[model samples]
Target: MDPAAGLTDVRAASPTTGDDLVTLDGVAKTYTTATGTTQALSPTSLAIRRGEFLSVVGPSGCGKSTLLTMISGLVPPTAGEVRIDGELVDRPYRHCGIAFQTSVLLEWRSVLDNVLLQFEMRGIDPAPHRDKAVALLDSLGLEGSSRLYPRELSGGMKQRVSIARALIHDPSLLLMDEPFSAVDALTRDQLSMDLQQVCMDRGRDLTVLFITHHIEEAVFLGDRVLVMTPRPGRIAEVIDIDLPRPRRLEDAGREKQAAYAAHIRETFSRVGVYRRNQHEGGQA
Candidate 1:
């Protein structure tokens, strides 16, 4: 019997619901370097339902970022296709928001100015969206910090600013790549909960694809957690999270959450995420 089986079942999605916002049909990616051809992603098929918070968890080099980049239309897959809202994504998709691992904020720009850069980049006047920018910052818990410079904020706060910037345009889809990985555990917990609330505020129209290596975070944030195999990645298993909303980090030991974490950790070990030959060299 498979361990991931009977665990919320990966939904058997698409073909029936017909409401998927993103579809990966036999999508795959490969790279040819001086060394040789490297398969970053294997042929895969999946569907992302509209308004769902899908968390993809994997160790480094598992093609997590590769999958995201393909969805963003930043790079074309070497095989198959990626479609968002039924349209082929041949170029960068304009209607979605993408937040990279680093905050990437400009030191010279004020927090509010940074949030408004999205408009500036699109040749739209930032003046008209200043109010929206402020509200987005406020919503993300950066209230009264709008005029503060990026250098003055903490790492977690800077990430919040990046979230604000990505969201100011009311994007239908949001893609986040380890946005909170740099923060201390306490701050990461706060940001995780805050993100859930923000997505809730965005209602049923907003879909989020969050990537992380943290098992707990994936379980806390995802409607369904897509587990991946190591490099040349493909779906290993997917576990659905049926816990009630407004998840609390304080409930770390809660049975269901602990179960999800444990199972995923098992999946990690089973998939060679922790190589048999490797050992921890650092002291706690």
Candidate 2:
């Protein structure tokens, strides 16, 4: 099944909001190694409307993670600037929440306490946020596991807890970096569905920047998917997913899903960043 077969290309028009929630102006990054300096990202510009779900996919070492760090203000960009709600992001911004590939839960903390850790870090009273934490856990299907330790949970449960923790603070922007890549395939699928629901439920208020290596995942979850080139990474394409909202994996036939995946795969191939043999036969 050639997924790209019979698919038409669609591009998203830039939104004309009075103020974009997030903006990257000619952002670029360079790293100084012991031997020499290496350029990681080329000058790239982007604007994210409030409450939009944007997925970014690219080959390894393409500065996908670096883009997230700059947006979160955890790391400074070598050039250009990242702004959230029109304010320059020069340090760790309290308006953003982040989750990485690993669950990174505190083994000693109960699930509820783990979710409340964000409050602790912000010097806010956890008491005020306890109900919200419990609600978030319940929403993610972790209702009864609040009292359980991280070690007692399955891989999927731990990731759910991580997500709950990230959302407990009610951040305006959520940055997720390959959050489901470490879980089993079945669990990954389930997590994908759950996260999709979360985005739909909160899409009117929360903006998400999701980074993943899986083309299918990116296509399934993004309103617009941004594809980057290999090393010295820059945006190669920004594909608007024209599918209906509240999408299910089974909603679009394999062909449609394959089409989306195939388009991204083709883009990578054109840049000499992807090889056909890297993926399994008949798998997106």
Candidate number achieving the greatest TM-score relative to the actual structure: 1
Clashing pairs in 1: none
lDDT per residue for candidate 1 within 45-137, as digits (tens), equals: 889889999999998888899999999999899998999999999999999998888999999999999999999999999998998888888
Flag regions of model 1 displaced more than 4 Å.
Answer: 1-16, 277-284
RMSD (Cα, Å) for all candidates, in order, is: 3.9, 4.5
lDDT of 2: 0.86
Worst 10-residue stretch by lDDT in candidate 1?
7-16
Write candidate 2's Cα lDDT for 1-284 as tens digits.
33343322212223436657888888899999999999999877888878888999998999999999999999999999988988999999888789999999999999999999999988988988788888899999898889999999998999999999999888899999999999998898889889999988996689999999988999899988888889998887777787887888875447666688888888787766856574557444
Q: Which residue runs of candidate 2 sit more than 4 Å off their true CA positions? A: 1-19, 275-284
lDDT of 2 at 211: 98
- Residue 121 shift from truth in candidate 2, angstroms: 0.9
